[model samples]
Target: MRRLFRLLTIYAVFARYRLDELLPDHAASGIVKFFIRLHPAAWTASTQVHPWGRLRLALEQLGPVFIKFGQLLSTRHDLLPEEAIGDLANLQDNVPPFGEQAAFDIIEAELKGTTEALFGHLERTPLASASVAQVHAGSLKDGREIVVKVIRPGIETLVQRDLALLLTGARWLQKIVPETKRFHPVQVVTDYRHILLGELDLGQEAANGAQFRRNFADSPVLYVPEVHWNLSTNKVLTMERVYGVPVSDTQSMLAAGVSLEHLSELGVEIFFTQVFRDNFFHADMHPGNVMVSLKDPQNPQYLSLDCAIVGSLSKQERFLLARQLMALLDKDYEQIAILMVEAGWVPQSTRIHEFQNALRTVLEPVLERPLNEIEFGPILIRLFQTARRFEMQALPQFMLLEKTLIHVEGLGRQLYPELDIWEIGRPLLEQWLRDQIGPGAIMQTIKRNGPALIEQIPHIPKLAWDALQEMRKLSENQQKLLQQVEQGHLKQLRRDRIITLLGLIGLGAGLSWGFNPHWSLSWSEIPLGAWVISALGASLILTRLRSNPDD
Candidate 1:
């Protein structure tokens, strides 16, 4: 019954989006066509809005869960066509805001103080409203402007229930369609669960903000909002409010004397710095979340918001990813293959040559275009599809990192179409490589690993002795196993040889008795085939006794 309800809800969403028109009928995918035919009345063609428009509208009506799904799907340009992906990228939480009193109640409860006590000046109206939370502009007691973000009443409950429903449906789908297990749908759900839960805690978001701020601490190119530690809570966040025109407002930015070219370059710098230097990035980077600092026209600074969904890479992953990108840039498909396997995105059993051919198929066309013309989204999607053929597992870390980078790149393109992110980013990458591989990097590594190395010095001889003892045991076990196989084979050989010897003795005695005309039975009375069988048995036993174990 729950399955039916969820399926019906999905069908309704599909109908609302009028996706039936965009999809093929009998020619579409088997599952898609089946769904379409079953709900002919539920879906309609585009007589009103474009398919993309309708999709956005449909996702909007479906609310947060579906919106977030669409948002994630937007990053997967490889799966959805460009048009559909564009529409989905536009999806956001535009649902009506919860009441201001509700927001006030949250702030008061989470901060353990009244709104007045928390903010020197508070607004009855929210600065912005969204599905999960709403923001209100206020002032701190020190007369500094701040944005008080409060979670909507009952949202956590709603999100939790919806996530449970999604998990149940996903598991049901996996059971019904075993092939989808290849996609690791369960892991995707778990990944989404982490992001959603992290978003629920305002303190985590504050921490994310703090990390970003620290990463770009001395940078003149970006401004991460300062988290108000004193007044922040798990459900409420008070941040140093930033005032600037949205990066999307090209005219306003131009009017304010911000340089679009420099702004675009700075955007790339921020991305490389986050990924290569900091290993942390703001994952939810929509246009609204980005703003331009008006004070620096020639060298624009970015003001980023909503750090609930950030990305991080492990040290090993970062190393492999950098090498992978560098290999792709150099057109060395073999290195790309090696690095991907090293990253564990591909299995060790993956045929490198075949993987290279698949990669070259998608990558050659992409590299043909100039770096500025590269669409990171479609490239990722193509790479994902090619890797999928080789049974690649999308490491959640890399997938999210790639998504964030694409988001940053896409935002750059939106603001400045001719922006060459790679141009601005390559120097940074080179410098980062130098800092990592140069003498300084070696010194740091030694510094970090030295203490542990010294601690192991006194135990080295004893540890080596222990390891040698273990090696001896392992060798003994292998020898025993080999001997057991040899013994079993020899036993079979011995049994055959013994049976043959007995048969030979009997056959020789019978033959001699017959030739001498002293046999007990007449030739007519004896079985004629018995002597032939005895002779054959003797030959078989001789062969078994001479048989080799390898054979």
Candidate 2:
């Protein structure tokens, strides 16, 4: 019943927004339009707002899952129009906080204690509230300042319910509209489900924070706060409180003498280092989750928070990504197309020349712009879009990476409009590529695997001997099989020759009986014995000639 109500609410919102009008002109759209017209609200739906604005508003009204979907869609420049992307980018998780008593109750329930007993002092007011959780300022008994995050009451059930509806809609869309398969609506919803569920688990977020903190332990450009595991649970997380100017507050940063240029460049460097060197990145790098430390004004450092969604690449993906970046920097469209096909991003049968031309058409103009004017994130989106035309498969990891890049690049460009991401990223990628394939890399590979290789040396002779014995046995068996086949062939030949000779004799007897002068052409004039002999001879000759020697 609850699910049915939710579904109805979604439809109501859809009708209220006149979302059917947003559908492209296709057979599926006609079916959708027919149904939408049946809803009374669709006739009176407001048309004052633009379609994109209505879309954003409708998603916000549909609740957190849809809002999160809008947030994700905002980064998909390849899939959505610029206006829609802009509108969706404005979608925020600014949900009203649950009551303070409820928050305290959840903390107590998850931690197995009273809130008062657990903390030095827990604030009744929330420091911040988002779709999944709310934060409250507090401290430990030892007076160490901290912030407590409590999962919203019953958000898991709500998330699951909404995700189910989204998945259903995605499947229906795919089934009804064949062209929607390229958009991978089902996969998008499925990936979103995992991301949303992961965010609900504070323990996972805590572990992510710890790993990120460890990755940048000695770094001057980035800082990650320590997780207080003793007080952390799957539904409750406590971490050391951090205070700094929000990265988005350019006025405050500038007042503190922070060099926006240096800060923006550092952001790019940190992004590349995390992706190439650590192989782990903070996927959610929105401004609300980032801050700037004022202690070092000239050399700004980034304070990262909310490590719920992190991304990493496999070794091969990392290598290919690096090569692709290098190819992009060198304006080698053919190499870029080749690498994409080799990486299995596109089908093996994809025409390289056509793909190259498509890539050039999209990228050449963007690359021709000044370094400061180029944006890697949008370039990647365009590249993926071109690849999609050639039937590129969905890559979840790459999607996360692309989203992160969008966040990082957007943040950088906001800080300094003249930020040259190409200038900052080119050297990092070049160095990483060299490290992977240079002479030193070969030595390192040998050094890492030498012991394992040496351990298997003593059994080499035994393995080789066993392989040779197996091959010899196979050869002998094959020779015996060939001999049997040859013998069968010889027997068949002899039998066929005997049958041929018998057939010839029978045929000769039939001819002599039919041409004899004593017998007239009429059947009545021939003797019964002669007739029987002639028939028997003809039957024998026909049977012998028709027989198959092999059978």
Candidate 3:
């Protein structure tokens, strides 16, 4: 019943926005059109809001999840209409805060103390509020400025409720619309479920921030705020407050003497570095989660926030992805197809030539376009679509990385429209690839794992003995299974011989009756049973022979 209410609410929002116009006239049935026409909001929608603008407004009104969905769609500038993407880009996450008292109560509960007891100063008002958490300014007893992030009260229940609705809708679409299978709506929702749930755990976010800080320690490109572990819990997180110009405020950055051209290049460099060099990245890098430091105006630095949804790829994936990108740079569609099959992204049975041609058809046009006119986000999306034809399963991490890259590249292009991402990123990726196969990387890997390797050396003999025992046990099990199979085959052969003998007897009796009609077993007296037995035996022998054609 609650789900029904939510569904109706969603429909009402759509009707209110007159979003049906976004769909084609042939998309809906006459009954749905009639009902839509009868709806009051359909006619009464505010005139000020344009047809495309209503999409963003309706999502905003629906709730945070919907707003975030719009934000995600906003990244796909190539796939979606420019006007729609423009409207969605304006979907701010300035959700109303839960009361100060609720925020304080959550902090107290998580920290096992009152807010006054825990901090020298705790603000009653929140500094900023978002979909999942709210931030409050405070000072520690040691005079350190910090911000307290508290998870919204009962957000888990809301997330679960909405996720159920989303999954239901996805399943409904898949059932009603067969073409939707290519989109993998259910898997997308499941990936989203992990991300949303992960955000609810403030401790994980704190850890991610700490790791990011460590990764960029003594570096000049990016800065991650220090996480105050003593004051943090799964529900409450405390970190050093950072102040800087938001990355989106281009005017402020420019006025502050920050080089937009260099800044744009740095954004691409940072993304590739995080993906290939560090192997860990802040996945949700919308402008809201990033800031620019004016202190280094000549060489500006990025301040990252909201590290809850970080992403990483396996060692092999990192290598393959880099190689694939390099292949794209070289316009080697054959290599791309081969790498895809080797990586198990596509079926091993996929025709290499056909796959290469399909990719070439999709990618050649974009590649032929001018460098500055190209968009990487939409190209990757189109590649995924093309891969769907060969039954390639989409990787969740790859998709996240794509979205983050899109955010970074899109923002970079916005900051400097002439930002050539391919031009900037190609050299960095090549350097990283060289590093991977270099001696320095091998030595570094050994040094990093030295302690663990030494510890395992002591157990080598025992480990080897145990492995041998396990293999012996597996061999015994296999031998027993083979014996059982052989016994069954022997039993079948014996039955076949019996059937053949019975068939010969029946055939001989039938022949005698046919040749000597006056005999006791006369042709007229011979029952249907004799003929059936003869046919059954002959069929068994023929089937057995066919099964073993070599015989």
Per-model RMSD to reference: 4.3, 4.3, 5.3
Candidate 2 lDDT over 402-477, as tens digits, reads: 8888888989989998999878898888888889999999999999999999998999999999999999999999
lDDT by residue (1-551, candidate 3, tens digit) is: 88788888887887887777675444433445566657787788664678778888888898877776677666543335657867997997788899988898889988999888899898999999998899999999989999999999988887788888888877876776666675577877777778788888998999999999999998898988999999999999999988898888999998988889899999898899899889998899988899998887998999998999999999999999999999987889999999999988788999999999999999999988887788887788778768877887657787678889888988998899988998988889889889889998999999999999999999999999999999999999999999999999999778766766776676666555445556566566667766665666566557656766565
Q: Compared with the true structure, what per-residue lDDT tens digits does model 1 show for residues 1-551? A: 65467668767777656676665333324576467557755545444788777878877876787678777767654345667777887786777778888888878887888877767998879888888888898899989999989888887876776678778867865776676677676777777888788888889999999988888887798888899898998888989988888888899988877777778777888888888888887888778788887876766789888899988888777777777777877889988887888767779988888899889988899988988888766677778778877777867767677778787887788878988777887778778778878999999999999999999999999999999999999999999999999999789877866766776776675566445455567667665565675566566556655664343
Cα error of candidate 2 at position 442, Å = 2.5
lDDT-better candidate, 1 vs 2: 2
lDDT of each: 0.78, 0.88, 0.84
Best by lDDT: 2
TM-score of each: 0.83, 0.88, 0.78
Q: Which stretches of candidate 1 lie over 4 Å from their true place?
A: 1-53, 177-181, 337-366, 369-378, 381-393, 434-439, 458-503, 517-551
Q: Model 1, poorest ten-residue lDDT window?
A: 24-33
TM-score of 2: 0.88
> Which residues of candidate 3, in runs, are more than 4 Å off?
20-40, 43-53, 73-87, 341-351, 368-375, 381-393, 441-551
